[model samples]
Target: MKKICIALDYNPNSEKIAAIGHAYARALRAETILVHVISEAAFYAMEYEPFMGYDSPFHLNNLDMVKELEQGAENFLLAASLHLGTDGIKTQVLEGETSDAILSFCRENRVDLLVIGTHSHSVLENVLMGNTAVKIVRHTGIPLLVVPTKMEG
Candidate 1:
């Protein structure tokens, strides 16, 4: 594999996924690219429910939240790449549907492999993220390394 794309989400499980993906890239001597896809800001707005007598999360309009979300995504990727301890690692913060953005990046970059995790952190994440692994599997033409990040019951 000449190029490997590691798909990551905001969930903590992504650390595991990123490490394993980095290992595979090292083993194959491939270029590593850390990719984080984010949906619209409105998607994240749901997480900020009115609390402590606060009016609402809706007060932060889409424009404000979008900028924050994009920045967060960039920082997340930067942290992940640093944690991987690879200076050559490239980070990308993609905007749009999760699976679609990932697949498009892989295709555009000619990625030979894709690494992703199967588990998410919360009900909100599951709802917002959906079954991204399944969607990517069904759609991607490149090889996939699916890490089992699902917690045991």
Candidate 2:
């Protein structure tokens, strides 16, 4: 059976990507693996902090924060799996660079298709903030299905 990997970033458009994965899997009769990559670096950098020694309390606090964020990411992925389960999709959670992890997982699992969600942001915004979907598309060799977030009515 063919394998499909759907990379979920826990964004507002996650459900739309899940739906696209569901439709694709149904049409292809392939197994779906929902992958969520939690970047510890990104999570930690979001908080401002002053420089501290290697064994300082600030370092420990940041480590704890990263652990909590990882746990939250895992929980989110679990909840997503349960929701997508209603549509018969399997899910998995991972931690690392979002694009690199997804591509590596696809290569390891021999995935034929990858699904991702894209936010509608301006070029300048994307240049400043970066886009995971664009990075994944550039790095992966397999076919990708990008589900753009719907505009609010």
Candidate 3:
């Protein structure tokens, strides 16, 4: 594989995922692209709930907040790229449906391999969240490596 795209999310297991991707990239002698897809729900929640005390509807109207989120996502990817410890590592932040965005990126970039982290989820959580990993697997032609965060009981 000449190019590997690592799908990242804003979660505690993200650093671990990056480490795994880094190791795989080194072993394969592949270029790495760290990608983070921002969720619109998360953007509003971060701007409105904690900071605005959930009082103002202004967060929904705030374009600046969306821009801020884009910047933050880019910064997060940059930090992850550094953590991967490879000069060939690149970062990208895209907004939209997570799985679709990731799949499109892989297709457009000619990625040979796709890597993502999956968390163990309860039945209800899986039903509600609708596993992005599964969706990506169903949709993408690229080879995928899913690194589980931990074993479930």
Candidate 4:
């Protein structure tokens, strides 16, 4: 059976991505894995570190901030899973660089297809600020589906 992995980011348009995933999965009869990658910056802000013996007050305060972000991310993912569950999609939450984590998950799971959303940006802006979708396409061997957000009519 073919397996599909949909990368989500807890964005406002996630439901659109999920809808696309559901439609594709239903048509292909593939199982879907909804993966959300929490960025390292977010994790660091959440104060998730192996060693807690830091001597700096600034580091300690940053750690506390990170913990709060982590908690929020956890809650967001949990809610996302519950919402996506209604569509019968299996969900996995991971923490790392967005592109790397998605690629790694795809490679490990033998993902036949990957579906992800692209936040619309001008060509100049995209070039200036590297887009995740572009990076994934450049790096991954797996088939990719770039779902553009619905433009306001």
Candidate 4's TM-score reads 0.75
lDDT of each: 0.86, 0.78, 0.84, 0.79
The total number of steric clashes, by the backbone 3 Å criterion, in model 1 comes to 0
| Winner on lDDT (3 vs 4) | 3
lDDT per residue (tens digit) for residues 1-153 in model 2: 388888887676898888788778878899878888876455563545445534434345677777777778778777776876655567676767778888888898899999888888999988997888889878888898888885877
Ranking by TM-score: 3, 1, 2, 4
Residue-level lDDT tens digits of model 3 in 1-153: 899888899897989888998789889999989999987635564554535345676456567667787899999998888776678688989778999889988889899999999888887987898999888878988789998997557
Backbone clashes in model 4, listed as residue pairs: 45-66, 46-66, 46-67, 47-66
Q: Quote each prediction's TM-score.
A: 0.80, 0.78, 0.85, 0.75
How much does candidate 3 score in TM-score?
A: 0.85
State the lDDT of candidate 1 residue by residue for 10-129, as single tens digits: 888898899999999999999999999887555655555567988665556756777888898899899999898878999998878889989999999999999999874576876786
lDDT for 99 in candidate 4 is: 94
The collision pairs in model 3 are none
Residue pairs of candidate 2 with colliding backbone atoms = none
Which segments of candidate 4 are over 4 A away from where they belong?
Answer: 41-58, 61-71, 85-88
Q: Which candidate wins on TM-score?
A: 3
lDDT of 4: 0.79
